[model samples]
Target: MNKYSYKDLPSRRERLFIALRLPAHIQHSLRLSAELVQGKLDFRKWTDHRDYHITLQFLGDTLVSDIGQLRKTLRSAGAGFQPFELRVSGWGTFGLEEAPKVLWRGIEGELGQLNLLQKRIVEATSSLGYKAELRPYSPHITIAKKFLGQVPGNEDKGIFGVLPEQDLSDNSWLIQDFVLYVTQPGQTPMYEVVDAFSFS
Candidate 1:
């Protein structure tokens, strides 16, 4: 018989953060819109299209040993909520006027439902010993980061001539399922369908 150390095990066995999927059409539109502002106003480096998602809760890093219980808790917590429609619109950045670290768009409509979903997710995973977020939840899909000065790498002043404003269209989608995702630095993140408890 041979004994193996924890470091020798495969990395895929790690636990993941979980979130809800954004509909394809809305994602496409957001990508196009982002390109229009690519060189202007010190936008944060953009996230890849496939990485786009509306996070319900950030589970942070967890040991592989804990994933099984997390899944079970999510299933139980998610059982009561039914599918709901969410609309994506508007854009903003975080930080002071001189420095913005994140650029993202806001979610609209079905606000109550979204909040309920987040609360349940938090409740489900709270017992895992992770630190819970104390601030009020504000749902937004982050598009960019790493922004420091006035649009670094661009010398053309014209690039900052016009900044894009938020779009207020009613782009909606039905949320049918959520997912658990494992993110690793310098590697593509992996996702798994923990359990899809359907909404009525």
Candidate 2:
């Protein structure tokens, strides 16, 4: 007889997702850019540097028992793609201009490959009953959330004009792998990597 048993259920469902982990150098670059506006903008929360990532798909409330099958499917799906290059390009936001919900950094380069890989993952996970979102996929890295600063006007051209452009012209990396991440709601550096799947 073993001390641990599968008969006992896990305490809770995990909030899960698949995403590309950013390289440290790029994270540093994004950090510096955000720091430049930290005093100028008054967002309620800024993303921790360590928690930065570009999400491919969010699997909300995942069952503990489903992880094994998800991992297997992810690995097999991931094996079909080749490594591709990407770079941080610009800035954007989601929600109202006066009070946006998320402030994010944009991505560019090799986007076709990125879209294909995302589509493949969606298809791979669909067999297990994961439904894709109805909205078109728009990839971005969240830098901050819930804008609290005074609203910008036509002359200011919105918050985009306030951000200082970092020298990311030569800053790009090959995305060789993606990871399964679990969200820790109240923790600093909220996301924890559960597994990583490499491309072919």
Candidate 3:
């Protein structure tokens, strides 16, 4: 399973990624919480609650031909390890402080264990020819993307000020399994979990 021959794959387009899909109740709670600050910011779109996920490894685009082997590799990667507790908390942005590009909520608890899971996924699958990202993992679930404008200098008047202290410790989940999701590029909330692997 470590190596793959390109010839064995059937060629068809799919953007694939590995992630932990948030449970329905958590997603609902997260959406409600995010709505509070969302009004203070200008975003072109908010991702649907059903689409929320915490990605473990972004596998990027792949042909449908590789999916079968990819699923097997992922299953092997996710074979061991018991479920651990993880919490969703806080909020942040990526890109510039004044004009953010993405708005996302933070994740906490059992981070080292989360990193280990990420590492195993990459190591087990990278040999199949997907380039492993070297960037440090910063796990977050995006609520919205494509910031429309800059935040005012006075942090208190805009999103920075609007954000209140959050503690979603009660909003925690057991990190038990990972899913392989597929989507056609540029489709809205069209993602589908093609396969899943549970930790033993």
TM-score of each model, in listed order: 0.80, 0.90, 0.87
In terms of lDDT, the best-performing candidate is 2
In angstroms, how far off is 127's CA in candidate 2? 0.7
Q: Comparing candidate 1 with candidate 3, which one achieves the higher lDDT?
A: 3
lDDT of 2: 0.85
Better of 1 and 3 by TM-score: 3
Decoy 3 TM-score against native: 0.87
Estimate the overall C-alpha local distance difference test score of candidate 3. Answer: 0.80
- Residue-level lDDT tens digits of model 3 in 122-174: 88888898877877889999988887763465355756666667845468889
Q: What are the per-residue Cα lDDT tens digits for candidate 2 across 70-148?
A: 9999999999588999999888889986678999989998999999999999999999899898999999999999888
Report backbone clashes per prediction: 0, 0, 1
- Report lDDT per candidate: 0.69, 0.85, 0.80
**Poorest 10 consecutive residues by lDDT, candidate 3:** 1-10
Q: What digit string (tens of lDDT, one per residue) describes model 1 on residues 1-200? A: 01334355534355466688776777787877777777565554678766788888877766655666777787777775788888887776676534567778888888998898888788778787755688898889888786755555444543324446664344789887687766655644234444454544
